[model samples]
Target: MTGIRIELSRRERAILRAVAAGRGVLVSSCEPALTIDGCWCDHAAVHNLVEAGLIEKERQVPYGLATPAVITRAGEAALAEDPRST
Candidate 1:
């Protein structure tokens, strides 16, 4: 996981778990729900995941937040690295 940086904090790992459990289009809320802790939407995670090619952000026109990310294959693969995530 060379290009994949960061030694994830405990809370960060939990957030990743929440993403994994997300179904449908994985449209997670900015505010975490029952299974997720809301505070995890930090810039650090978004930057790192983007750098690692594990997620993507779409520029929304006439919609909600201009840049919201949906998980990618790399993200699922990254999550698969931890058994707790799967």
Candidate 2:
């Protein structure tokens, strides 16, 4: 299989690492479809991550409900490559 390289900022990397650490499952805001570490994350950052194929938004819940952010295999690979990640 071909390999993919995704360059992410410190925050983006940390977000992906955290999500991956959670076993590829993370609760995100429903309406905004954001929030990485309990706070609202940059919309563009989230979009970039998703576009990079590292992360994906799960089914959308109600307006006040929380949704899930799932880490793709590519996300796991990125986290594995991050030396600062645990």
Question: How close is each model in CA RMSD to the real structure?
Answer: 6.1, 3.7
lDDT scores of the candidates, listed in order: 0.49, 0.67
Show the lowest summed lDDT stretch of 10 residues, model 2. 23-32
TM-score of every prediction relative to native: 0.48, 0.68
Candidate 1 Cα lDDT to native: 0.49
- Report lDDT (Cα) of residue 78, candidate 1: 71
Q: Where does candidate 1 stray beyond 4 Å?
A: 1-9, 22-40, 58-64, 84-86
TM-score of 2: 0.68
Q: What is the lDDT of residue 46 in candidate 1?
A: 52
Model 1: which ten-residue window has the lowest total lDDT? 31-40
Candidate 2 structure quality by residue, lDDT tens digits, 1-86: 14666668887887787666553333444323456556776777776787787887666555566657778888888877767766
Candidate 2 lDDT score at position 38: 69
| Candidate 2 colliding pairs | none
Instruction: Give model 1's TM-score versus the native structure.
Output: 0.48
